[model samples]
Target: MSLFHFSIRIKSSRLCLLNIKVYFCFALAICLLGIKAEVRANDRYEIVINTGVSEKALSVNSLRSIFSMHLKTWSDGTKIRVFVFSDDDQLHQNFSKEKLNVFPYQLRSTWDRLVYSGTGQAPIKVNSTEEMLTKVATTPGAIGYLWRADINEKVNVLEIK
Candidate 1:
């Protein structure tokens, strides 16, 4: 081939390789973002309660008892006000199923029944973990759960059994 044709071919090949590399990098970035999103989605949480209330470590049963009004007062006689995340939230769903050993729908139905019957009041619902933490911190006799990563100094995190 002539010199000019050979140079053109080299430049064209280099451009094609560069385009392929860019596309590959873009695809890799997208995959990494997707993986990060999924990890965030399934992030686990630790249950936390107010300080100086119960020396007894919390468990699913204890949590249920407190939430369902079976256990109205803490060991110290502090009336418990349970704070809960929204029923439709994914984190709430996972936490309920994994930690609470109950489904969101079941919890909702239970709350509804309690509200309707005037037997007990359901826990106050917060839209997000941050809000739950904030409300739990500011409000006395409050208890709630949130993602471990979402915890901050605003609230006291109680150890669960």
Candidate 2:
């Protein structure tokens, strides 16, 4: 083949390879963004309280105290009944770590200390989010956490400050 033709073919082949690389990179970026969006969606949750509870908001410190079985009453003199799922539950773990800024194991130890020391009681444990919603909705002064998708009008969402 002529040198001019050979050079033109090489240039065309390189351009084709470059186009493939660009398309691959673009596809990879789109997949990564999709994964990140899914992660963000999974992380969503809410802290729910019984509608009877007067408080509409609470500091993160107060929430941590309540979960740790330290704060036993609301500001209005009513008992604050805290409910939670199992320590290994994903929602429970996320709530403990994200909202309370504590690990599930740490919360477990705190509850154990309170129980063993005769100074406090652990939060009520429910097996599922359905039970959590029902208990918190029916019980006065009840507080619990639930996935955002599981929340309904029966309970009031408490804003964390």
Per model, how many backbone clashes are there?
0, 0
**Lowest summed lDDT over 10 consecutive residues: which window, candidate 1?**
35-44
lDDT of 2 by residue, 1-161 (tens): 69999999999999999999999999999998875211333358999999999999999899988998899999999999999999978788778877887889999999999999999998999999899999999999999999889999999999989
lDDT accuracy of residue 26 in candidate 1: 100
Candidate with top lDDT is 2
Q: Across residues 1-161, which tens digit of lDDT does each residue of candidate 1 receive? A: 69999999999999999999999999999998875222344446767665545454776688877766567787778788888878877777777776677778888888889889998888888887668877887877788888888888776776657
Model 1 vs. true fold: TM: 0.67
**Candidate 1 RMSD to the real structure:** 10.5
Off by over 4 Å in 2: 1-43
